[model samples]
Target: MTLDPEDSKLITLARAARARNGSAEGAAVRDETGRTYSATDVTLSSLTLSAVQVAVAMAVSSGARSLEAAALVSEGDPGSADEEVARELGAGALLVAGPDGTPRS
Candidate 1:
């Protein structure tokens, strides 16, 4: 599938985050207001959060009421938590990409 330029940019950001952190996943989200947030998965022994979840939280904390789009780059599929958060925040779509930034499902 062909992704829009914005979508491709998000994928690139996510891929960079993942590579920088050496994490299992990385994600980027665009808020309705055009602001963007990115994060890598947190895998602490006491707590764990997916990259998508962290990105969503960042948006929320920054006072964004809704999300326009979300992108996740990972070896595995983005989990249900990612989908649920995106849906709850009214994201337009969830874009899944591989570690190499290739669009997946």
Candidate 2:
């Protein structure tokens, strides 16, 4: 399937985060204001957070009250929590892309 340019940009950011941190997953989200936030999986011994969760948290902490879209780039699929959080933030799109940055159906 084809991806919107904005969504593609999210995938690019997510992919870069994954590569930069050598994490298993990376995620990016766009807020209602069109601002974007990106994060990688946090796997510290005392803390474990999905990339999606971290990205959402970043947006919220940055004063984003709602989100427009989200993208996850990983070998694995996004967990239910990822979808739930996006939904709660009013995200219209929760895109999942492969590690190679290919959108999943």
Candidate 3:
């Protein structure tokens, strides 16, 4: 599945976060799994919507059993803009899983 516009916004903010933090690379916190994953840390080459789908699929098929209890950004910090993205995306529940293995909250 493709990421919704809200998700796109969130990703943009994430990239911005990396830029602000002066890190060329940073992890996208997976709310579902409370895991920090890099765009290229696994098989994902791009941060596109399609990549998110693939990542989520891989995570589930690879024995990740319970993402419901996980947090989306366990490491890097998300700015208010990012938080807004999440809010707009209705990802504040920590119960909804995104296609990229990130929690909706």
Candidate 4:
């Protein structure tokens, strides 16, 4: 079955995987009023693993990062709730930039 593009469980796994091996890349959160906020603490990179990795890279590039306490989930679980999983992981929603630098999710 095809997975929902917005699935958070898959996103989390992908992010974790990137952290483990993928090289950390910087993401551009925004550029307005000569000010910007970025998620520099966490590592973000796309090593050609899966769609999830691409999504995650976009999120981080959009300035999303893990909170003090965050819940992590896998797509293998039932009733996979996107927001719920993020809340459990103490993580906030992430925004990833598309090829054109447009924010995704």
> Best candidate per lDDT, number?
2
Ranking by lDDT: 2, 1, 3, 4
Worst 10 residues of 2 by lDDT: 85-94
lDDT, each prediction: 0.92, 0.94, 0.37, 0.34
- Cα lDDT tens digits, model 1, 1-105, are 999898899999999899999999999999999999999999889999999999999999999999999999999987888999988989856899999888986
Model 2: runs farther than 4 Å from truth? none
Cα lDDT, model 1, residue 24: 91
Error of 3 at 63 (Å): 20
Can you list the residue pairs that collide in candidate 3? 29-72, 29-73, 30-72, 31-70, 31-71, 31-72, 91-104, 91-105
Q: Write the per-residue lDDT of candidate 3 for residues 1-105, one digit (tens) a residue.
A: 366554544455444444555443323324354443323112336643322232344445556543322123223333454344334423353223323445444
- Candidate 3 lDDT for residue 4: 59
TM-scores, all models, native as reference: 0.96, 0.96, 0.26, 0.22
lDDT per residue as tens, model 2, 21-75:
9999999999999999999999889999999999999999999999999999999
Residue-level lDDT for 54 in candidate 2? 99
Clashing pairs in 4: 58-96, 59-95, 59-96, 69-90, 70-89, 70-90, 71-88, 71-89, 71-90
| Whole-model alpha-carbon lDDT for candidate 1 | 0.92
TM-score of 4: 0.22
Considering only N, C-alpha and C atoms within 3 Å, which residue pairs clash in candidate 2? none
Q: What's the C-alpha lDDT at position 95 in model 1?
A: 93
Evaluation by TM-score, superior candidate among 2 and 3? 2
In the range 1-105, model 4's lDDT, one tens digit per residue, is 332343333334434543444424222221222222222124338433223333334454655553322222222221234334434434455333322223344
